[model samples]
Every structure is written in C-alpha cells, then in structure tokens.
Target: MNAEREIRGSYWLETAPGGAPAPPPAGDVSVDVAVVGGGIAGLSTAWELARRGREVAVLEADRIAAGVTGHTTAKLTVLHTLVYDHLRRTRGREGARLYADSQSAALRRAAEVVADLGIDCDWEEAVAHTYAEAPEHVEALRAEAEAAREAGLPAEFVTGTELPYPVAGAVRVTGQAQFHPVKYLRALTDDLKRHGGTVYEGTRVTGLTEGEPCVLETDTGVSVQAREVVVATHYPIFDRALLFTRLSPRRELVVAGPIDADRAPRDMYITTEQNTRSVRSAPHADGTRLLVVTGEHFTPGAPGAADVEERFARLTAWAQSRFPGLTPTHRWATQDNDSTDSVPLVGRLHPGSRHTYVATGFGGWGLSGGIMAGRLIADLVEGREPEWAGLYDPRRLASVVREGGTFLKNQAHVAKHFVGDRLPSVTSPAPEDLAPGDGAVLRVDGHQCAVHRDDSGQLHAVSARCTHLGCLVAFNRAERAWECPCHGSRFDPDGRILQGPAVRPLEPREITSH
Candidate 1:
C-alpha cells in the first residue's frame, strides 16, 4: 500500500484518534489560552482552563492522541523505575516526599477526572511492582521501600512472590493505577468541546510570536490570537535551539496479547535489568486476560523496533513457559524525552518569554508527568503558586554533577550535523515511484534533499540532514512526518518544525538539476 494509505489505514482503521478535533478558528478569534498539540497533555490543559471559565482552543497537526500517548502501556504508577531511592539520595528526604506526593496526587486526580466526566476508559487499580533479578539489587529495592515509607506512601518489599520468574526481591507500591489512554482522552476531548473549547485537526501550528495577543500561525496562513500559549507539544515548539542541549529522546516498546486468567498475575511488574522488562495484565472484553509486556534498549537513536520485537518474543516465550497458551496479539513503540535531571520541566519556556509555557522531559513517565504538568500549567496561568513550582522550573540549572557534561555532549551532537556537511547525489523519480502525499530522500546535485509531492503534485524539497543534530531524519510513514533518530526532533513533510530541539527548520535544499 502507498504511504498515505498506510497511515490512513492504521490510524483510520485500527481506532479513531483519541481527542475531538476543534473547528478551525474563523477570522480573528480570541481566547484566554491557545494550546498546541491535541494529545492528553494539551486536552487536559485545555480542560483545566475551560473549567476556570477561560476560552480555550487546541490546535493539532493531525488527529488527537496520534503521537506517543495513544501508543503507551498506560501504566499509572508512582513506582517509576526505582526513583524513590534516587530522589532521596539526590534531592533529599523532602524532595523524595514531594515527588511521591505529586505522583500519587496525579493518579488520584486522573481517577477523579474520570469519575467526574463519567469517562468509560476501563480505568483500574493495580499493585505497582519493581523487581530485580540479581540478589545484590535487592538492597536497592529495599532502599526504595524505605524511601516510600518515609514519603508517606503505602509500600513494601517482597521476595519470591507473585511472578513467573524468581526475583531476589521486589518493591510493591500499593494503589498505583492503569487504563486505556485513548478512552480517557476521548472523554476529555468531548468535555472540552462541551465547555466551549475549540479543536482543529489537520491544522499544523508553524510558529508563535510574543505580543499583546500571542499569534499562533498555521501552515495554511491561518492564525490564532490568544492571551497565552501552552506548549504541551511533548517537545517544546519554540526555543528549540536552547532546549535541544537540555533534553534527549529515548525509545520504548509495548506488546499486548492473551494470557490465561488463572495464570496471569494481577499486579504490574518491571525488572531492574539494564534492558528492562515490564509485565502487566488487564481484563479483556471477553473476560479473558490481556497481558502487556514491555522493555528493551533505552538509547537515543537506537534501532528499537526490532529490538523491541525480540524482547517481546522473549517475554512471551517466558510467559508461555510459565503459563501454557499465552500469546501476543498487538505490538507498538513510542519515543519520549528525558532530562539530565529526573524531574520534568514545567514552567515558563524561558526567563524572557513569560507568556509562553512548556512541559517536556517526562522520561517515560508521562502518566504522572502529564497530569503534573497540566496542573502546574493550570496553576501558572491562573497566577496561583504551585507547591512544586520551584522543583521543575525549566531554566533552573541541573544539580547533578555529570549534567554539564551531558549538556555539552548534546551540543556537540548538534554541531556534528552542520560542520563540514556534503550533499548526496540525486536519483531520478520514476513515474510510479513518487506518489501524492509521499516523501523520500533523493540526491539533487549530489546533496541529500527530502522530496515530497503533495496531492496537487507540487514537489517540496529541503535538506535531509536534521537541523537539531546531524542524525539523518527518517520519513515517518505513519504520520507523514520527518523524525530524527538521535534526538527525536520532528518536522512536517514540508520542512516545517513540528516538535523540536531543532529551532530552525531544514533550509530548502538547493535543488540543482543533475
């Protein structure tokens, strides 16, 4: 199938996009807030504003939840990969307590929102488990348990209990949760529309400028006038040049399949292996159980899909050995941003841009991070002081020692993309090779340039080398977008910056005839 058909097939066929698309803004529509990106973060932020009687509008590049949120494992837990001990040691007892409280509160808030909205999102409560295979690592688990206790959370250590594989010991964090992301996002989208909010799908935001009324420009020349902008774009849409050095992206995978109800474990578990393994199960509509296992490599620009497939195969094989008749049915992968520091950035975009706000670097914990960010942004917009505000200021210098080195390293990564660059040779586009709404890299005058033919047969060309870092950008078949493997910078097919670490869009390639 063609690229357009492939994307339209997966997104349109498997499931409808999660959030509701708002009507395009007509003329000069004014709003209290304009939210960029229509995923869970954007919808939730818009929802919070609408509840406060603020006029809100959300603009999406494509359908809502078409990004990472729709494809997540949907694990909602305070147990984020042995964080308690790390937080305690790094940030101190108080910092650890605050982090725990924030995540626990986020879980409760999500449940409250579901109940209040009457959202039928298959929400469920489950025990959150973090285990280790090596006996020596049991000490770390115990430390986490002790930290959790000190933080006023219900937590404990378990040894050799409730798993197919024997573990040295595990940390059990009680009352953690999980649910279907799309289902929840759908309800939020509906509520936002009912509350006089607007959503615009297929309307891509290209740029934003600071002014009395901020201007959000779209690809088609449409503009949104708003008092403030909330960039819940997962990655910052502006100041990409600066934030690029501060954040790096990581990839993860998830697989869902059938498991015997009697044999499936009731709790959610993740291992402490370098290439971690996660196991969790939920009830299927047919009363059988569905197990979702995830794990594998965590590196920037790592070849992940195949690695994830292998890990899933290994996990399923392990599961079947422990419980005969288990099999995997669905598989998906996603990319997420990480900061050198553990906490996410949730405040003003920078010191000078007070009107602009951003939320990024969730570090594979968007469940808690998204809710925390939404609440924090809501508080900021309302001019209320959030207790955790100081903890997550985007501009604050990271306290960790090696952070400076990493920041410098990220800058070096970006530098490599531009220094001493050469173009690749152009190849002829066969009559059948180029299709409407399809894109490919071709050699033009011996330089690599991206070529995209719109439905109208107009070809758009841009430098293939991503501006964020030197990593070659790939044409995302599913999203009809350009994605960078090294740092997760994404651009639209027309050379427009979508998500960033790359502040500048790839300059139009000098298309000289070969």
Candidate 2:
C-alpha cells in the first residue's frame, strides 16, 4: 500500500462500540419530521423531536457520526478560538453575549442528556484556556476575557501556569466540557431509537418537493412524506436558495497519540497563534490518556496537497518535538462550513416558511452549535418560537454586508477555482504518474479526469469536474479522496459520492488496468 494512503482511523471509532451498519430505507414512509444527515445536528433533532411526541425519521447517507461529528476534536466549549473580542468588535457586545449564551445553553443540554441517559462517555468538566505566546497578544486575550465576562460567560484573565511551555497571558473559562463524541452520539442514537424515532442509514436524500406534505425523494427510489424536513447534512444537499454561495468551507486536521497522563494538563487549551494548536486529552480503553491536538485549518482543493501536507507534517513534527517520549498515533482530517459571518446558519430555509429547515455553516464550533441548532429547528417544527432564533437567522444578511470585504473575497476565491479549474491544462501528470493508492488529475480520453492507482496496481478514474457546480476536484492525500473546492462536494477515488451538495456520483471515466 502507498504510504500516502495510510489510513489514520479515528480514535473514537476504535474505542466506541457500534452495531452493524443498517441497510438503507427500502419502502415509502411518512413521519412528522424527516431529518436528513445523521451527524450530531440531525441526531440531536431526532432525539429532541421524538421526545416531544413527534414521529421522526433520520435519513443518513452513512452511519451516524461517520461525517464531521466522528472526526471532531469534541471540545464542548463556548470559547471558540479568539472569538469573543472579535465578535464584540464586529457584531457588538450583545451579539457576542448571545453567541456565548446559546453555546452555554447547549452545553447544559448535553449535561442534561448525559444525566437522563446515564451513559458513560468520559464526560468531564474542564477549564478552557486561550493563551498567548507573544507579549503583544496578551492584551487580546485580556480583551477577550472581559468581553466574555460582559457576555455572561464565566471568563477571566490570568497568568497561566499549567502548561509546561511559557505563556505571556491567557483568557480562561471554567466549567467547559469534553467527551468521547462518537461514544456519546452512539449512545444518543440508542436513546433516539428506543423512543420510537426511526433511523435509516445508507439513505441518501436527493431532493425535497415543497408541498403541504413535503415529499423527500431519496436515491433509492423511496419517498418520505413529512410535515416538516430538516437539511442537517454537513453541506446542505441542495442550494436552490444559494446557501452554498454564502458558506466558506474550512478543512482542519486532528492528530492524537499516547501520552503520559501524569504530565498532561487537565485543561483543554487553544493558543492565540496564527495557526493555533488546540490541545486536549482523551482516555484510551487501556486506562492511558491520548494527547489529542488539532489545528492547521485551511481551505481544501486549493491547488495541491503540498501546502496541506506541509502544514500537517509540521503539526506531526511539533507533536514529536514537544513530547519526545510519546509515540504519535493518528492524523485525520475533517472540514466544516462557516457563514460569511462566524455565526452558524440555523433557521428556516426561507422567511415565512413552515416546512423546510436547514442547519449548517457551524465553523469550528459545530459540537455545541449542532446541539443549539437542533433545539432551534425542533422549536420551529413544534410551532414554538425559540428566543435565539433571530440571532442565527439564515436570511439575515446584516453580517454579510457588514463583512462585505470578507464575504466578497470568499466568493471571489470560489469564482477563481470555478473558472480556472475548467480551462485546458496539459501539465497534469499522466495516469501512470500516480502511485498505488494515490490520485491525480490526468488527461483520460483527452478530457481532464481524476485518476487513482489502487494499492493492488489497479486504476480508478473519474471526471475531474465536480458534479455540484462543475468546479475541478483536487485529490486529498490524507483522506484518499477527491475534494471539490467551490462547494465542498467530495468523491472517492472510484467516483463514489462521499459528501455533497452534489447528489450525483462523479462521472466515471473508463480506466484500463495498468
């Protein structure tokens, strides 16, 4: 097998128990709510709605948490990076407070669920810290702590001493939590099903017809007629409302391995570095703790893996350099969407809408945001208005215009890839250039196609063009898949759809065996 294709499987998958993957939905069914995508948001929605006496059905293209939820760092904290100070500056103090309040509420909801279910998922309450390495950034941390305090967050500024490394200053929030995300969500699925909420894995939702009883069309030719529908898929399947145009996709890496538990800091920390390092600890089944580190977020499909790989290699080296005695274990990647503004998009798909809903653009804080979104969506489905709904309204373009420069810049970046990727380029390497388990953009039958050589010296080729918006797809070496830059649609080397706003699989190009 090619070293590039070395699978960095999730620690959660190894530790968490799961049942056999359920078969796809086989026949027509109707329910009060049809939730698409079984990640945290959808599952949370199903759990909440089912408890409220609504018959719910969760349709998942893959297993629950198999998407970004399974790949998360799982720091269930409201302190997302250095966001409080910036949110105050950009969206005002009230906006920052609302964001903090929402996340805190979601955290409380998680605690409530844990207590109700009595599930053990290594749930721990720990302090959250944002430390600054340089002297000048100390004020930034101080400002953030103050801002967080004003926003009803229990935050304070201090000289941190837990870290082995030196730090100028830090903003600290106490009572933040962390847990085994996969284990927690898996247990939640059991609770959901036990309560009469049906779950259907391997059911891909292709389209939704807006009618009195919303008709959800699936790839398997089955239809779900529901009074309300939620598009909780990481990237909402259809962008007929131009949701894709408003989102900026961000890809990040998580690396974890064995660590001396006696030495690791109890607090989960994220530094104020340009490319920040998110540090936390995970408990292994063998009673050892794994030092989990995450950072180096970048846009995927930005030309080559050289930049992403270089960033990843640096994180790996840093891990090795910092903890010389510990051996590194896993290096996996995940991507999430962010609205032009940092706030998540959680509301009705359109204004004055009753049946359709969407929850996406969660940025780096999808863990808690997913919970919050589930609450908001559930409120809407139950005809009860949530107070925080106005805060995360998807139709509100005030932030988009306020951050016009950033919003336009992101759109321009996507435009550049959409137009530039299609133009003829002969420099793309030939099919043979790809090693086993490696992929590349090659000219197959005179049309630019994505070609991958499997470890067994077999070839798999698919059209280089993305099925979503016709943008070119780039091979992600870490994940061993083709990722589209424009709208974050992804495909396997054999052209199977992995993620989408594109329901169609990548068009296959006939490849002769090598």
Pick the TM-score winner: 2
For residues 392-491, what per-residue lDDT tens digits would candidate 1 score against the true structure? 8887774535366766776676555445334343444532466776667776665677777777777777887887556666565434567676677777
Query: Against the true structure, what is every candidate's RMSD?
Result: 5.1, 1.7
Most accurate candidate by lDDT? 2
In the predicted model 2, the residue pairs found to clash are: none
TM-scores of the candidates are 0.83, 0.96
The CA root-mean-square deviation of candidate 2, after full C-alpha superposition on the true structure, stands at: 1.7
lDDT of 2 at 343: 83
